[model samples]
Target: ASARKKKGDSASSTTPPTPTPPTTVVAAPRLSAAAKGDKTDESDKGSDDDNDDNNDETVKAGSESDKDDDD
Candidate 1:
């Protein structure tokens, strides 16, 4: 047996799912003091540079494997 619909029940009461905004990558502005030839503390600067090493291929190996399986 089917259940009866309640009074004032409208399927349009719920809001529709919104489309995700187009994703974009934003870059940091060039370091002004570095660009201007004003030197900051060298050790701190070197540490920051090391943090940016692009190891995505090594770190994201699982994702690459998934893509390979999808082929």
Candidate 2:
């Protein structure tokens, strides 16, 4: 019974520290982004613009292919 109680106490102690790590992990990335002069935001916007351009090009290509097929 004493051994079982010790095991239970250890498990509960371990569980509390598990929650702390995630808060630190969440904070770490924001710190890295700030350290890099917040380029993460600019990179994300640039990626979005690239995606838009690719989508437009795909639409144009598809239309051209369709016209070729019709001819």
Candidate 3:
């Protein structure tokens, strides 16, 4: 009976660690999702900066045309 109890205790101990691995597996995907979100945000900022540069160039071109008309 003592040997049987020891075997049961060992099984119980091993079962808890089996659940721990799944928890780590679940957390890994969450971290990867967060990293992807950050990359998307950076790309959006880069696109916005490009739009601002285009707007500035348009304004400069408009001003130059206005100067030619004035002359």
Task: Note the Cα lDDT for every prediction shown.
Answer: 0.50, 0.91, 0.94
Best by TM-score: 2
Candidate 2 lDDT by residue in tens digits, 1-71: 99999999999999999998998899998898786776766888889999999999999999999999999
**Best candidate (score: lDDT):** 3
Backbone clashes counted, model 3: 0
- Using all chains and alpha carbons, the TM-scores for the candidates as numbered come to 0.23, 0.43, 0.42
lDDT of 1: 0.50
Pick the winner on TM-score between candidates 2 and 3: 2
Count of backbone clashes, every candidate in sequence: 0, 0, 0
Off by over 4 Å in 2: 1-40
The CA lDDT at 19 in model 2 is 90
Order of candidate numbers by lDDT, starting with the best:
3, 2, 1
> What is candidate 3's TM-score against the reference?
0.42
The C-alpha stretches of model 1 lying farther than 4 A from their native spots are 1-40, 54-71
What is candidate 3's lDDT per residue for 1-71, written digit by digit as tens? 99999999999999999999999899999999998999889989989998999999999999999999999
What would the TM-score be for candidate 2 when compared with the true structure?
0.43
